[model samples]
Target: MNIQNPNRCFLGVSASVTGRSWADRLDARGAQTALAIAQRHGVPDLLARIVAGRGVALDEVPQYLDPSIRALMPDPDSLTDMGAAVDRLASAVLKGESVAVFGDYDVDGATSTALLVSLLRTAGLDPLFHIPDRIFEGYGPNVGAIEQLAARGVTLLVTVDCGTTSVETLAAARRLGLDVVVIDHHLPGDTLPEVTALVNANRQDDLSQLGHLCAAGVVFMTLVGLSRRLRDLGHWTADRPAPDLLQSLDLVALGTVADVVPLRGLNRAYVSKGLIALRRRQRLGLTALMDVARLDGPPRPCHLGFLLGPRINAGGRIGDAALGTRLLLTDDPMEAKRIAAELDRLNTERQEVERAVLEAAEAEALAATGLEDAGASIVVSGEGWHPGIVGLVAARLKERFNRPAFAIAFNGETGTGSARSIPGVDIGKAVHGAVEAGLLVKGGGHAMAAGLTVERRRLGDLRAYLEGQLAASVETARADRALAIDGALTAGGATVALVEQVAKAGPFGSGNPEP
Candidate 1:
C-alpha cells in the first residue's frame, strides 16, 4: 500500500519548525544508531527513524515493544480511594448484598461492566448490571435508572466508565440508601458526587502512576485491590483460586483500544498481555467475533479499532449496547457466534446510515459558512440525523478538514451532537464551556472527543461558541500540519523480522503510538 504523506500532520506534530527541531534532535541523538538497532531487530528503517525522531530511548524499547504486566504494571494501592472501594465491594460480596453496576453504553463501559461482573461472579457474588441508553438516558447515571436499580434490591452500585459528572444521579442513589462506588476515567467537575468511594485516574488530585488507564483498566486495578484486601482479611486462600486478574486483560485491551485512550504506562501492559490472551482464543466470544469479522489471525489494535470496535460500538450506537457486554461475557461458542454475526450486520447497517448522514452534514456545514470553501473547523447540524453516527461523521470531517469538527443530530425540538478535534485543541473543554454557558443541557469528554445534548434552538449559539473557542487554536493546529518522518530508509529495511521486533513495542494506540 502506498503511504500517503506519512509526514503530513504526523501525530499532530508541526512539520515546518517543531518538526525540524524534532528532526534535528533525532540527528543529534544518533538517529543512525537507532536505525541500526531497528535493522538488527529486523524492523523497517523508516519506522526506526520515526521512533528515533520521537526521542524514545534505547533502554525504553523493551518496555515499549515487549510490554509485560509483571514489568510495566503499577501497584493497585497507588490509586487513591482504591482501598476503600475494594473494601466496600468485598463487604458487599461477603454479605450477599445485591450490587448494581451502572456503566456507559460505549465499548469502555461495556467491557468494564463485563470485567467487574465476571470478577464478582468469580468471588461468588451475583452482580446486576445497568447500561444507560445513549439516545434515551444519555451518557451517565440517571435518577430514573438509579431508582429502578435501588427498587430492585440493589444495595451497592458500582459505576464504570461514567458517573463522575453525574452529581444528581449519584446523589439520588445515595438517598435511596445505596452505597455507590465509582470507577471512571473522565475528567471530574468541581464538586464530586457524594459516593461511598470515587476511583478515577483523572481525579484532580489523583497520584496514581497509571493515569492513562481506561475504564476497564481501572476496573481491573480495582479487582486487584479487592483481591489483595480479601487476602489480607483471610477471606481468600490458595485452596480457593484468587480471581485471575490476567484473564480480564483482554477486555481491558479491547476497551482501551476501542475508546482510543492513550496506551502508555499500565495501558501498554494491558494491551500487550491482552493481545497475547486474545490470540490464544481463551474467550469464545472474542474468537467468534474474530470469525464473524473474517479475521484469520490474532486480533491487532488496527483490527480492534477499525473492524471489531465499530461492530461492538454498533450495538451501543444503534441497537442494544448490552449485546456487546453479553458477547464478551458469554462462554458458549454457538451463542457467541450468533451474537458476533448480529453485531457484524449491525455494523454494516450503521456504515450505510453514516454515509448518508455525512453527506447531508457536509452540505449543511458548507452552507453555514456561506462560502464555496470553508476552513479547517467544520460544525454542522441537521434534522433527523442519526445520533448513533454523528460521532463517526465528526471524525470523518475532522480528518478531511484537518480541524475540529462537530456533527449534531437535530430531532425537531432536541438535538444531540458529537465533536472530534485536531490535536492541541481541547474539545472537552469547549463542550464544558458550552455547558457552563447554558448552551448545552450537558456535555463531557476527553480532549480529542466529546458529546453534547442541546435544544434545537441553541444550535446556532453552540456553533458560534465552539467556533469562537476553537478559531485561533484551529489555525495554529492547521498551520503546523506536516508529516515528520522519523528517518528515511530503503524498502529493503521493511522485513518480517523488523516488523516482529517492532511489534514488541506495540499494543500501540493513542499517546504511545507505534512508530
Candidate 2:
C-alpha cells in the first residue's frame, strides 16, 4: 500500500497477527533517494522506492539493477591463500595426481563438489569425491574418510563447505600424507588447521570482505584462479580447451540460493547471471530434477531453494549421501533421471519426518515457554527424533517464536542438535563459545545457522548458558524486528506491468528481502 509520507507507519497498526509491527522501510533520506532514482532513471515511483529501500545509491542503481559477474567479481588472488591453493591444485592437475574432493551433504557442498569434479575431469583428471552421511558420519571431514582417501592413493584433498573447524580431521589427513586445500566459507576457530592452503573468507586473518559468498561461490573463485594458473602454464592445447566457466554458474546459483547465503554484491551477480545459465537447462541432472519437481517456465530463486534444492538435499538428509553429487556429475541422462526420481521420493519422505518432528518440537517449545513470549532462546530435545530433521525444526522454531532456537535429537547419552538464529544474533559464535566452554562436544557454522554435538545430561546447562550469553542480544534483535514495507499498493495498483517492474530488483532472499 502506498503511504504519502514514508516516515509514518503503514495503516498505523501497533502490532499485527504475527506479533510484528508494520513500518515504512524508507525514512526521510531514503524517500529522497527514491525520488532521485525516479527522476534520474525515469522509472516508476514504486520501483524507485523498492530499490532505494534496499539502500541502493543513485550512482549504484545501474549496476545494482543489472549485476554482471565481470563487473562485480573481485580478483581471485585477493582472497587469502588463493595463490597457494591455486598453485597446489595446478600442480596436481599438471602431474595427473589422484585428487579427492570432500564435501558436506547439503546443497552447497554437493554443488561445490560437482563444480570441482567437473572442472578437474575436463582437465583430464577423474577426481574422486566423498559426501559424508548425515546419520553415520554427521557433518564435515572425518578421520576415517580422510584415511580411506589417502589409502586409495590420493595425495591432494580439497574440502568444500566444511573443514574450517575440522582441525583434528585435517591433521589426520596431513599425517596420512595428504596436502589439504580447504575451500569453505564457515567461521573458523582461533587455531587454524594445518593444511597447504585453507581458503576461507570468514577466517579471522582474511582481508577479503567476500564473506557473504557461499561455498560454491568460493569454489567458483578458486576455479577462476586455477584456470588462470593452468593457462599460464600452457595447459590448454588443441586436444584440450578451457572449460566454459559460465556453464558452471548454474551450480553456483543453485548452491548459493539453497545454502541461504545473502544475495548481495558478488553473490547477487552470481545468482543473477547463474539464473540465466540455469534457464538454458544444459545440465542434464537439473533437467531431470526440474521435470520431477514439475517446475514450469523459467526457474527462479524460489524454484531452486524450495523445489530442486530440497530434493537434492533429501538424498543427503535421509537417503544415500552421495546421490546429490552423483546426480550433478553424471553424464548419462538415464542415470540422471534415476537419481532425480530417487531424490524426489526421499524428499517426500523427508517432509513427513520433518512434520512429525516439528510437531513434537513445537509442543515442547510451547510447554517450556507456557504460552508467554519465548525465552531468549528455545532448546528442545526428544528421544528418537531424527537428527537429519532437527535443523529444519530449529528453523521452524526460530521463525515461529522470532528467537534463536535449537532442536536436539537425543539417542541415549549423546545428542545431535541444530540451531537457527534471528537477525543481529550470531548463532555460530554462540555455538563456538559453548564448545570452548566444554558444554558442547563440537559445533560450528555461520551467522544464521549451526550444528553441534552435546551430552544428554548437559542439555539443560547448554540451554542456560545460551540464554545467558544471548539474552540481551536476542532482546535487542526482537525489539527491532518489524515488517519493512517499502511502499503500499492498492488493489488496482497491483498490475501485471507493476509486478514486471519489481522483477528488475530481484533474485531476492536472505539479506536482500523482497520488497
TM-score of each: 0.90, 0.97
Question: Per-residue CA lDDT of candidate 1, range 1-515, in tens?
Answer: 01233333334444455333122234434567677658666555655665555455666665655678888767887888888899899898779899999888888988999999998887778889988777888788899988998889999999999888889888888889999999998777667888988998788878875666778989988888888877787777677667778877888889999888777767778888888778888888888888889999768888878878888899989988788999988989889999999999999999999999998877777676644256546888888888989999999988866788889888889889899987778888888888889999988887888988999888778777877888888777765544434544459977787677556556667865555
Best by TM-score: 2
Off-target runs (Cα >4 Å) in candidate 2 are 1-7, 16-19
Give the per-residue lDDT digits (tens) of candidate 2, residues 125-223: 989999999988999999988888988999999999999899988998988899999999999977899899999999888998999999999999999
Give the 10-residue window scoring lowest on summed lDDT in candidate 2.
Answer: 1-10
* RMSD to true structure for each model, in Å: 4.4, 2.2
Worst 10 residues of 1 by lDDT: 1-10
The segments of candidate 1 whose C-alpha lies over 4 angstroms from its true place after superposition are 1-48, 370-376
Number of the top-ranking candidate, with lDDT as the measure:
2
Per-residue error at 220 for model 1, in Å?
A: 1.3
What lDDT does candidate 1 reach at residue 135? 83
